[model samples]
Target: MRLALAAALVFAGIDHWLTPERYLPMMPDYLPWHLPLVLFTGTCEIAGALGLLLPRTRRLAAALLALYFVCVFPANLHNALNGLTVDGLPQEQWYYWLRLPFQPLIILWTLYAGGLLPRRATAVAAA
Candidate 1:
């Protein structure tokens, strides 16, 4: 799960770089330095993804990545609320609404996969 999440982040980071314009609309108008912010977040995603692979960095990476998700959530909310289109793809209101609730799940998943959360013990059958 950790590796899969890392791969997803890497792919997303690449997408951010490849088509930044697609993400521009997601940025809140009140925010400054849009392009740099996009690039910075993309870089962080890539770095965090790579960090997740190393044992020593895995926990830190997971924590950071979770925070990153939290930080960018507003953009996701904004995109959903405004019915914003991206890369010529038109999304329905329901689509955005559906995505809203998944953010916390992603955070919890990251924490668990990164070993930050306590592992659940399996029950053993009595002989």
Candidate 2:
């Protein structure tokens, strides 16, 4: 699942890299260096996706993936808060608002699948 999430993120990052202008307005006004941000995130997605496929690095990759989500969250917030638009997405605030709740679900899945989340001790005790 983390691998799948990484792949999906790669696609999303590529979209941002491919069209920085479209995403630029959504980036937090306080942030600096859009070019590096776009490039670094694109590279991170690709590297993280590959890392997730390797058992030895899966945990670290998932942690990074979770962090990546947190890092990019401001863009989503900007979109929702300022009515920013993107291609291939519906131009509606409702759509952006609906996207907020998905962050935790996706981040949790990434961590769980990558084994970054510790197994519950209660489950072990019960067994």
Candidate 3:
């Protein structure tokens, strides 16, 4: 799970640099330096992915990534609410709406995969 998440982040980070325009539509008009912000976020994602892989940095990385997710949520909302069809994404409105709920799950996944959250303890049978 951790590896998959790291790989996905790496791919997404690279995509941000390779095709930033797709992300531009998601940015709110009030935000300044959209291009630079997109690039910076890409860098953050890559760094966070790397951090997740390291034992010492896992917790911190997860926390930051979760925060990052929260920070970017407005963009997601703007995209969905405006019905903007970003390049390479499903053009269907339902797809955009469906994605919104997944953000929290992604945040939770980051925390769990990073070992920041305690796992469920199993009940041991008394002999």
Candidate 4:
């Protein structure tokens, strides 16, 4: 799970750098310096992913990442609500709406895999 999350983050971060224009429409008009902010977020994503892989930084990375998910949510919501479109992405409104629920799941996955959350205990059958 941790590895998968890290891999996804790395891919996304690289994508941010490779095609930042894809992210511009998602930016809310109230925000300033969209390009720089996009680049900075990409940097943060890469850093957090790397940190998640290290034993020493996993918890902090997870916390920050969860927060990052929360911070970027408004952009996602805006995109969905306003029906914004980008190249190479789905044109279906349902696809964007479906993505909203996954944000919280990613946050939970990050926290759990980073060891910030307690593991679920399973009941053992008595012999």
lDDT of each: 0.87, 0.80, 0.93, 0.93
TM-score (C-alpha, index-matched) for candidate 4 = 0.94
Candidate 1 residue 36 Cα shift, in angstroms, is: 0.7
Regions of model 2 farther than 4 Å from truth: 118-127
Roughly what TM-score does model 1 have, to 2 decimal places? 0.92
* Lowest-sum lDDT 10-residue window in model 2: 118-127
lDDT of 3: 0.93
Model 4 stretches with alpha carbons more than 4 Å out? 122-127
Evaluate residue 109 in candidate 1 and report its C-alpha lDDT on the 0 to 100 scale: 84
Residue 54 local lDDT, model 2: 87
Model 1, 3-79: lDDT tens per residue? Answer: 89889889889888888888898899989999999988889989988988899999999899899999999998998
Ranking by TM-score: 3, 4, 1, 2
- Per-residue lDDT, model 2, residue 39, is 74
Whole-model lDDT, model 4 = 0.93
Candidate 2 per-residue lDDT over residues 1-127, each given as its tens digit: 6657767877877876787676666777788997778777788878877778889998898899889888888788888998887777888879998998898887898898788887676645555
Worst 10 residues of 1 by lDDT: 85-94
- Each prediction's TM-score versus the true structure: 0.92, 0.83, 0.96, 0.94
Give the residue spans of candidate 3 off by over 4 A. none
Lowest summed lDDT window (length 10), candidate 4: 84-93
Residue 114 displacement (Å), model 2:
0.9
